[model samples]
Target: MGIKSSLSKVFASFVLKKIESWKFNAVDAQERTLQKLIAEAKNTVFGADHHFHDIKNYQDFKERVPIRDYEDLRPYIERVVEGEPDILWKNKPQYFAKTSGTTSGVKYIPISKESMPEHIKAARNALLTYIHETGNAKFVDGKMIFLQGSPVLTEKHGIKIGRLSGIVAHLVPAYLQKNRMPSYETNCIEDWEQKVEAIVGETLHEDMRLISGIPPWVQMYFDKLSEKSGGKTIKDIFKNFELFVYGGVNFEPYRAKIEASIGKKIAAIETYPASEGFIAYQDSQTEKGLLLLADAGMFYEFVPADEYYNDKPTRLSLGEVEIDKNYALILNTNAGLWGYSIGDTVKFISLNPYKIMVTGRIKHFISAFGEHVIGEEVEHALLSVANEEGVEITEFTVAPQVNPAESELPYHEWFVEFSKAPQDLAAFSLKVDLALQQKNIYYFDLIEGNILQPLKIRTLAKDAFVNYMKAQGKLGGQNKVPRLSNDRKIAEGLKDYIK
Candidate 1:
């Protein structure tokens, strides 16, 4: 091993020990985190308003602070935007992570000095854990690229404002600076297409090993490499490439297509990151779920997904969560977001060390006929059938078709983009329908009672989702089409691309 590789192994060993110490004591770590957050923020404006000083336990917190989404916290955020101090956290935030919201036009999520390092540390430890487990530290010496938004920042009242990924770009550690790829100028390209092209030009022949990004954008980079290299697989172009790290979406649906592009199966890591916090990361290659970051300067609360909209939902702390149950994730972070709803739903797969799988968004589901099928269910249903039928799907989305032609019953419409179409589309559709019925009992009852017809599939033309997102000005950079929608907005928009 080279000098860097040797140093990496030693560092990984050290970090893994520290991780083990916390992982085994997850509940205690979480309790300590809550106490620390409460003690530190009690002097802030929100703390006083919410009676944080009197909070002594989880029950007190639940009664004192109400759950708040971005809209509910907008007044405080607005004041902070106008250069106010100590409105949320102890002092002014170091940066504001700008993100596009569905109802709220734009959101500015604070990144306090205390919270910023946690993001970097969690990401670092994820890789370190991999190294310690698999003895694979050589990738550290090769060039790495993270497909992301423009790193260019705009100033809002002295706070740097940019995408979460872009803000993270500014914080890449000094040790990895030389090994990181697609020069700063290339990363600053506002247009994603041009950015990918530039990235391909910069790293096409370099010793690239680690490629990290949300899957679709990484797929775009792979496509560009294939085009430039005259259809050669990624393995052929970058012989040293080994690890694929992804976040923001589940990797299973895209797994077949991505591995096909690479021409081989490779080691991969999944992470759960958001503008609010870095919640979890896959700690073991053999493990089923991402290990929750219980001590990462944040405390978590989980409300049962079914009861999320109710007046008084049951909020459970880490020790209270159970395996295989879906919950809407809530956060109280050092960044000064208390009882904040980030809108993502997750399920605990392992509670021994608190591991979870991101199930879907709280708002992204189809329940027109009371089925309430989520993102995980739809993806699972399709993937199970696709694997059996040897089909390769590029992308897909589900929406409730509440109305149909005369004499026809309403059904769920699945818009699918296929790289490899199945031999028998009808038979394939039936299999997928059966799989979904098995996963969701309500949907099965609806079909059996003749309240709705079997779901229908609409094959989309090649690059259909890409074109749709492009038209919406959300072509890349953390933007993704919802896997499931209650309304026909996306389904209607996708009609033009139907084959």
Candidate 2:
């Protein structure tokens, strides 16, 4: 191993020990974080308006702050964007993470100086934790590539504004600077397709070991590499490539196809990151869930997913969360977000160290006929069946086909892009439907009551999703198709690409 790799193992060991010290006291660490956040921003406008001075405990906070989405918090965010100081948090925010919002259009999530380090630290710790557990720091000596947005930033009222990944690109640790791939000039390319092409050209022969991105984009790069290299597997192109780091979407759906592209099983780490905060990461290769970052500069609250739309949903602290129940995640961050609902639903699988799995989006579900099916359920159902049948799915989405052609029973329409089609598609669909019914009782009841028929799969053309996203001008960089939708907007758009 090189000097850098040898020293990285030492640093990884130290970081792992520090993480171990606090992970066991997760609940207490969360309490301390809440207290510190309140103390630091007490005099700020939002803090004062929300009675932060009078806040004494989690109860006080629950009573004072109401759960809000981006639309609800737009007024305060507008003030900040218009150069208002101390409106949300103490002083001015260093940057705004610009993201596309469904209802609010453009969302500018503040990234305060105090909170910025948390994002960097959590990401670093994820890798370090891997190295500490596996005793594999040799990847640090090889080229690493993170498929991401351009590092270019725009100014909104003197605060830098850009995508979270783009902003993070500017903050790559100095130690990894030399090992990071896809030259800065190539990284700055605006178009994603062009960027990938440029990246392929630059890193094709490099000693790449660590590759990170949302799954689909990485797949795109791999596809291009394969095409350029006369159908060679990714493992052939980069023999040293060992780790795959991914987030933003469930990796299960793409796992088979991605592994096929790589030509082998490889070490992978899952992460749960968002514009709001770095929430969790896979702490152990053997563990089932991502470890919630309890000591990160954020306090978490959970409202049971079923109760999320209710006027008075039960807002529970970290300590109150139960295993296996889906909860709408709420955040109170040092970045000045108070009781902010990032619209994600998560299920706690482990409580000892507080590990969770991203279940779905609160807004992203299919319930046209009152059979509320979530992202996780659909992904689980399809992936389960796919694995059993040895099938490879490229991408898929589910929407209720409430208005099927005359006299046909209503059913869920599954738009699936398959890399390897099942010989018995009807059988495959039946297995998937059965799996989904087992997971959701409502869906089972609906099917049994003749209210809904078994889901029908509509095979999509090659690169259908990519084309759909490209047509919508959201081809890359953290954008993903919703796994389930109540309405047929996406389902309709996908019709053009049907086989």
Candidate 1, poorest ten consecutive residues by summed lDDT: 1-10
The ten-residue window of minimal lDDT in model 2 covers 181-190
> What RMSD does each model have against the real structure?
0.7, 0.8
For each candidate, give its TM-score against the true structure. Answer: 0.99, 0.99
Query: Candidate 1 residues 1-499, lDDT tens each?
Result: 7788889999999998888898989999999999999999999999999998999999999999999999999999999888788999988999999999988999999999999999999999989999999999889999999898888999978888999989999899999999998899999998888889999999998999999999988998999999999999999999999999999998998999999999999999998889899999999998799999998999999999999999999999999989999999999999999999999999999878888999999999999988999999999999999998899999999998887998999999999999999988988998999999999999999999999988899999999999999989999899988999999999999999999
lDDT of 1: 0.93
Q: 233-331, model 2: which lDDT tens digit per residue?
A: 999999999999999999989999999999999999999989889999999998799999999999999999999999999999999999999999999
Alpha carbon RMSD to native, model 2: 0.8
lDDT of each: 0.93, 0.94
Residue 474 shift from truth in candidate 1, angstroms: 0.4
